[model samples]
Target: MSHSVASPSPKLSSWTHTIGASLEPWINLTRVSRFAGTMLVFWPYAWSLTMTARSANLPVARFFYLLFCGFIGASLSHSAGCVWNDILDRDFDRQVERTKGRPIAAGKISVPSAVAFLWAHLGIMLWMVRDVNSLAFKIALVTMFPLAGLYPLMKRITYWPQAWLGISMNAGVLMAWAFITGSIPASAFVLMGGTWAWTIWYDTIYACQDKKDDVKAGVKSTALLFGNSIKLVLALFASLMMSALVVVGRLNGHDLPYFLLSVVGGSIYLAVQLYAVDTDSPKSCWAAFHRNGFNLGALIWAGFLADYIWAAQGPALVDFARGVAVGW
Candidate 1:
């Protein structure tokens, strides 16, 4: 009886199937680790914008605008970079355990689709930075073009690709300060330097995860090059970051307590990372990599408190609650 009117179920069109496959790649591209890394990079810009706004005595709305523009540009730029990296490193990615499941490496995504996504994100980033400041837009352009083209080559040639990547990440400090103030201040160099060291140091830790696979794949990274001496390198890099923070705080005329607070906070955070990390254990190394978020948070909080203290010309904690409430 059932065979009398048998009919086939409707099949999805080619376009529908294409779109379904495309979505998974985009979703995978926006991994949690990627999101966290992006957020950490953008946080300095947000913090700097708030400081500039407070220094000018502007309302929270103006500060929010700077933050909005910076976030949009940075996020779009990061999206493009991620897609491009996946495309370029697809073959190498398949050799690494953590990266093996990525959409591009898994063959779930087409290279043409990834390229289209990259171009779209780049266009959006360009538009966003244009609205912020010409100087920032220029910086974004400089950072994007060279970094995007050359970053993939790092794995092929240099063990310190993370250091080169640091330059790209910390360029945000200059972009943010110039966008808000319309000029590069002395503070910009100090902050940028600190950000650079911090990024390189943390990224080195992250690279540890891929060290074994990377070596097997004939790729280079600091994790392999530094070998057993990574801890020493990380400690030195972290020290440089803290030193930069101290110098910047002083130049901005922050109280001694402000400088001390940041140094101590950063040091404690770094100690937790350096002391507890077991480079031989991939699990421990991954944990250490994730802990950088806390380190960054400490630095941000210290900077915010210091800036508020300078503005109030009083104890750092005096206006802590009020400063936080007003987005300072």
Candidate 2:
């Protein structure tokens, strides 16, 4: 009886390997190590929520809840967009030294498997935003098609794929505004414009990493389009972004501190990045791109958070001061 033990079935082993292989590529394709990109995508949404909550006196708990939702939505949507991009650009990725190791390009995943993964991500994203306000939900629906569906094709048709990306990526500013205010505003568009300019600036830097391969592969991008004038283009976009920031701050009645930290500080950081970036060096381009996540993104959010805290607490502090004065 003890000698009657049986070996594992070959069919079971084959099925196990198939399941693991199917899921493994998803982790690589999502580029989870590049967490910076996800946070950068999430920041505009968080900023809108914080600013709107401050101005509207919305409950702090509600603001946090919505911000968390934006984080999850942004991450899922960004991952889906990446998978779609990889699927569309598999051939192009194989030609680029930097992207040649990508899951789809390396043939670690089949296109059908990738498509399935993409739909799964989109399905979860939809579920996450389902409880949001109607305006936000509608905007999310409309924008998802363009960002996740059309963005991968833009690179084939236009040198301004970065511009398309700008429009798509920053649409979150509007969605977040609608989520909180139940309607979008003129100011939200202004902020969106600023966010668009910022996208062009940083994405151009990101594109620089693949400029040589992109050109060889006939892939058009702002990095290739701008060429020797790339720095000038970055400067112009950075200025536009800063101007938009100033306008949005004024529209929202943000205090001097907000302008100083978000607008001024962010400008200085961008300037340093521009100065330090070597457009010809892929390493420099990658560094500059990642820097945008923390330097500009965190600075802007810090200003908004500080402003919100002060606005919520300032009256109490003033009242205490007045009471002390009267007692004295």
Candidate 3:
């Protein structure tokens, strides 16, 4: 008699499934662990807010206050966006392996429930931004509906849904500037363009994971549009993204840290990711997309933060640096 070796994978998977199924349907519907995507929404807001704070010499207390508000706002909006996307794609999601188990697709949550949840996020977001400048409030409203709301539909009719996402995701760049400054600047629009290009860069990689499924499901994406030349097109977008950021730095008069970390380091990291990702492999594509949200985002935000702090307390930082250089 021989004892067959039972691999641990199935047991581990069963345990994971059990834990997953135990969660409340609403939480699962939100994909609460998609923090990466949520943070992507927050970063543009933070970066632009800091830039405006530095330029306007706004009080540090207020800056932090706005930053906190921005974080809360981003989380809510991203959740709402996810709910909206899921609602519109529930049928298509059922046909895709990666999305088939999603709450709506799996019959764990009804479309009505999902829509109600989406409304909940939107209502909270509206309340949070109630005191914002009217212009900023309108922009925020636009982002929630005509922009993010239209994103899922874009995939049905166009190959450039990523382009729409780029616009929607980075619209916060303008909203932050408007909220704090009461006006948008040419430089902020330039920054929006850069982040827009970046959204396409990362999302096309993300889309690559579902290329085959998307084709059969009649979905459109940049990954399928670029086809054999996907990498080439992505590289072009990468170049456009970096170039726009550099231009915005020039326009905004950002500190050397912005140039070094956000521009130089950012470009290097992007090149590495683009080179290392095997778009043909779903795992590789997902890894690259995740890294963009985590690592790449950090680089850009660090530089913006450094510039903002230096502007806010330049003389103090210089004095502190001098003391450290002389060993106190």
Candidate 4:
């Protein structure tokens, strides 16, 4: 008797189930806050602010080319990094209450599958920026290395991992500026540095929510490490963030009004953060962390608005799109 070879069925049901299981926890939606935090870290707002500094006489074609490309690339990098971070931290995540239900941590995605997905996301980021300057490309590559590798381990050993996280997040700002201008100026460095510090301060507040679980799991974090002093720590960092912003304004030769208005807005926001912050309360920590998004948007707007005010009607708002297109 000859045995007939059997062909495999499509297994559509199994495939659909598998995909649904894998995607459901990722769609938790509360995670969107984390993603937003990641996006802000890329400082796309800062890039837009810098574009406002470009001369109006510059060709619109090049400005928009740079603007669109820079914005999209930074966004992709931000998303890819966030996804990859979730993947890498999956194992450790299960040990923490807040993260235990995440898709990867819950075994909805197997470790190998999560790893492949991370690489794929990062690959997309690479392809997105392929046409950028060689120097910028190299910087981007180096920047992502830490995100995929060392960043996950940071919580294992340091209370200040948020500092490194900020560096990774701000790397896009530096790379984009260099890609457009072909050189790293003191102004870009200073502004990006300020943005980085701002990220650290805010992310620390975020980490505060997980402090108890993190300590139980033997993970180091600013929240867990600071313990009873987290409020004071937050105040210190917030003050430093404002000081850095003031330095940025001075470095850019912004007028006193620019500094006063921006700093006043920032101070008011910071005061709000300080007044209601409660390190031991996870709900309060989440609220405080989300407030940073507003701060990020406000700070960027402050800088851009100041530039507009000082530049005498600011390069014809109608030409904004055209100017961005041509590298103004």
lDDT of 1 by residue, 1-328 (tens): 3557655544656667778776766778756345666666676666566556546665556666767777776677667777888999999999999899888889878899888878888787776666666787788788888965688788798878877888787677777677767887887788778878888788788888888898889888888888888899889999998888777776666655555566676778787878988887888877776667555555755655556545654545567767898995
TM-score, one value per model = 0.83, 0.90, 0.91, 0.79
Order of the predicted models by TM-score, top scorer first:
3, 2, 1, 4
Query: Which candidate order results from sorting by lDDT in descending order?
Result: 3, 2, 1, 4
| TM-score result, candidate 3 | 0.91
Q: Tens-digit lDDT track for model 2 on 91-112?
A: 9999999999999899888899
Task: Name the 10 consecutive residues with the lowest summed lDDT in model 4.
Answer: 49-58
**lDDT at 20, model 3:** 73
Clashes of each: 0, 0, 0, 14
Candidate closer to the true structure by TM-score (higher is better), 3 or 4: 3
Candidate 4 accuracy as lDDT: 0.67
- Report the lDDT tens digits of candidate 4 across residue range 1-328: 8999876566977888889875665554125536556446445445433533442323456655655665565555655555676776777788988888877777766667666766776788778768878888888888878553578778777877887777777776667566766676676676667666677677778888887778777888777767787778777877776776677666656665556666667777787878888877889878777667655455655654565455544457547868888995
**Candidate with the greatest lDDT versus the true structure:** 3
lDDT of each: 0.74, 0.87, 0.90, 0.67
Q: Runs in model 2 with CA error above 4 Å?
A: 1-24, 320-328
